[model samples]
Target: MKNLICLTMLFAICQRTVGQQVELPKATFAMHTGFLFGVWGNYEARLGQRTVFLTEAGFSFQSMAVFTNEGKEDVITPVLLVGPRRYFKSKISKKKSGSARITRGFLGAHIKFKPNSFFLDSDGLYGYANHLGVFPNIGMKKTMGERFVMELALGVGYAHYFAKQEGWPENIDRPTVDLRIRFGFNL
Candidate 1:
C-alpha cells in the first residue's frame, strides 16, 4: 500500500514538471506581391512537421520590364504559382514561452504559369503569349504576433515564351528572377 502511494506521488510530480506542448498553425492565408508584378492571394497548408504546400493566384497588369527589352510591352494576364516550402528548426522555435518570437528559414521550389498573356507593344499593337517558368527559392519568415506573419523571398530561374511576335523570333526564352514580400495570418 505504501509503495502504491509513493508511485502515485511520483506520477503527480512528473506530470507537474512537464508542460503542455505548443500548438502550431495548420494553415495560413496571405496577401503578397512581387512574384509576377501584382497582388496575389496565397494559401499554405502544413503537410508535415517541417513542410508546407503553398499556392498563389492573381491577375497581373504591368509592363514586361523583367522579361523583354523589346520596346516596353504592356502585359495583362493571370498568374498562378505552386510550390512546397520546407522550414528549418531554429533556437527561437524551441522556446516554450507564449511571447517567444519564431524566426525560421525556408527553401522552396516553384512553378509559375501565365496563360494567354495579352500584351501591347510600344507602337500600341496587341499580341498574345504564354509564359512558363521554374524557380528555386530561399526565404525567411518571422512571426510578428500570435497571428501575423511576414516573409521575404527571392528566386532565380528561366522563363519561356510561346507566341509569334511581330518582329521577335518565335519561342523566345529569357532568364527570370522573382522577389516577393508576404504578409499572412494564421487560420
Candidate 2:
C-alpha cells in the first residue's frame, strides 16, 4: 500500500508539470519600404503571453532634386523609437472543424526622435533649418499564427525648429507622423 501511494503521488506531480508547459507565441521584425519614405526595421519581444516591448532605429532620406525651389538637396535624418505594447486574444469557436486562431488589438506609447534638416539658398549658401522633436506613439497589431505576427502603428507629436533660421516663417511649428511594421518570432 505504501509503494502504491508513492507511485500515485509521483504520477500526479508529473502530470502537473506537463500541464504547465504552455507554448508561447512567435515574434517578428520588419522594415518599412514605402514610396517617398525610408525607415529602419523594428524589433519586438513577446512577454507573459500578451505584452510586447518594441525598439526601432533608422533615417529618412527626402529627395529635393525635382524641386525648382532654392533648397535642392537630399536630406538624411536619424530616427529612433521605443515603447511597450499589449494584446488581447480572440475567442475560439467550439466547432470540431480545425481552424487557425487570429489575434488583433491596439498598442500605445513609445518614445521617438526626429532631427531637423538643413537647406541651402538659391545662391548656394548653406543655412540652418528646422530643429528636430520628440514624440510618443500609439499603434496596433494582427497575428495569423501562434508563432507569427504583424503590426501597424501611427505616432503623432509636436516639434520645434530654430526661430533664428533664415527663411523660416514666423509661428511655424513641427508636427510629424510615424509609421512602423513588425515580423518575427512570437516567443
Candidate 3:
C-alpha cells in the first residue's frame, strides 16, 4: 500500500510540472545595424505580456552623409533612441513541422536624438549640427531556438535641425526615413 501511494504522488508531481506553460523572456540585449546609426547596442525590457520598452545609445559613423554635404567625411556622432513597442499576435502556421515559426509584429513611436555633428563648411568654417526627431515604426521580431531573436523595422518621420553654421538651415520640416535590422539574445 505504501509503494502504491508513493508512486501516485510521484506521478502527480511529474504531471503538474510538465503541464505548465513556457514563460516568456523578460529582458533582451541587442545589436543594431541600419542607415543612420551604423552599429549600436540596444536594451529592451518587457513591460507586459505583449509590450516592451527599449532604449539605445550608440555612435553614428554616417552622420555626415545624412546631415551635411560632406559625403566622404569620416564623422562620428552620438545617437540615442527611446520608445515603447507593442507586439501583436501572429496567425501564421506551418504544415511540415506542425508548429508555426514564432513571429510577432510590433508598432512603436520612437524619439531619436543625434547631437553634435562637427563638420567643416564649404567656406572653411567649422560648424556643428544637432538633430531631434520622432519616428513611427512598424517591425517584426522572430524568435529562434531559446535565446536568439531577430527584428526588422522601417520608419518615416520628421527631423528638426539645430545648427550653428552658416548656410545650414534650422529647418523643422525635414523629412527622414529609417530602416533597421537587429539581432539579439534574451538575458
Candidate 4:
C-alpha cells in the first residue's frame, strides 16, 4: 500500500512539471531581416501572456554606383531599435491541458533608430546620414515546440535623418515602411 501511494505521488508530480513548460514564454531571442533596416536582431521579453517588449541592434551594408569617377562604394552602418509587441491568439487550437497556446497572430509596433549610410555627394565628397523612425505593426507567431516561435509583421511610419557634415543636408525626413520576419526561441 505504501509503494502504491509513493508511485501515485510521483506520477502526479511528473504531470505537473510537464504541464509547467507548455505555455507562455517569458523571453525570446529574435532575429530581424527587413527592407528598411536591413539585417538586424533583437531580444524580446514578455510583459504578460499576450504581450511582449523588444529591442533590436544590427548592421546594414549598402553599396552605391556612381556616375562620376568613383565606381562603387560600400557603406556599413549599425542599427538599433526598441519597442513593444502585443499578440492576439487564435481560439481554435490544440488542447492538452484544456488551455490553448496563444500564438496564432499578433498586432505589434516598434521604433527603429536607423543606421547611418555613407554616400559620395555630387561635390565628390562622402557624407553620412542617420534616421529614427517608429511604426505600428501586425504579425503571426507559431510555436513548433516548447521553446521556438516564428513571427512576421508589417508597419509604416515617419522618419527623419541628421547629417553631421556641413552642406550635407542635415534635415532630411520622409515616410518609412517596415516589413519584418523573426525566428526566435524562449529563454
lDDT, candidates in the order shown: 0.68, 0.52, 0.66, 0.59
RMSD (Å) of each candidate, 1 decimal: 14.1, 15.1, 15.2, 15.2
Which of the two candidates, 1 or 2, achieves a greater TM-score against the reference?
1
> Highest TM-score among the candidates is held by which one?
1
- After superposition, which runs of candidate 2 have C-alpha atoms over 4 Å from their true positions? 1-28, 47-49, 61-76, 88-101, 115-136, 144-150, 162-173, 179-187
Candidate 1's C-alpha runs over 4 A off are 1-24, 33-37, 60-62, 65-70, 74-76, 91-100, 117-127, 165-168, 184-187
Pairs of colliding residues, candidate 3: none
Alpha carbon lDDT of residue 77, candidate 4?
Answer: 57
Best to worst by TM-score, what's the order? 1, 3, 4, 2
- For model 1, residues 1-187, the per-residue Cα lDDT tens digits are 6534653454344334432333346887776554445667888888876668999888666667424455556665688999887665433543445566677766677889987644444555354567889777778887865767778888887788775643446677888887777666554
Candidate 2 lDDT by residue in tens digits, 125-182 = 3434445454444455545444555556666755555554544456346576666555
At residue 93, candidate 2 shows an lDDT of 29
Residue 169's lDDT in candidate 1: 63
Residue-wise lDDT of candidate 4 within 11-56, one digit each (tens)? 3443343212223457677654544435566787888755578887
> In candidate 4, residue 118 scores what lDDT?
41
Candidate number that wins on TM-score, 2 or 3: 3
How far off is residue 110 in model 4, in Å? 1.1
Best by lDDT: 1
Candidate 1, residue 68: Cα displacement in angstroms equals 10
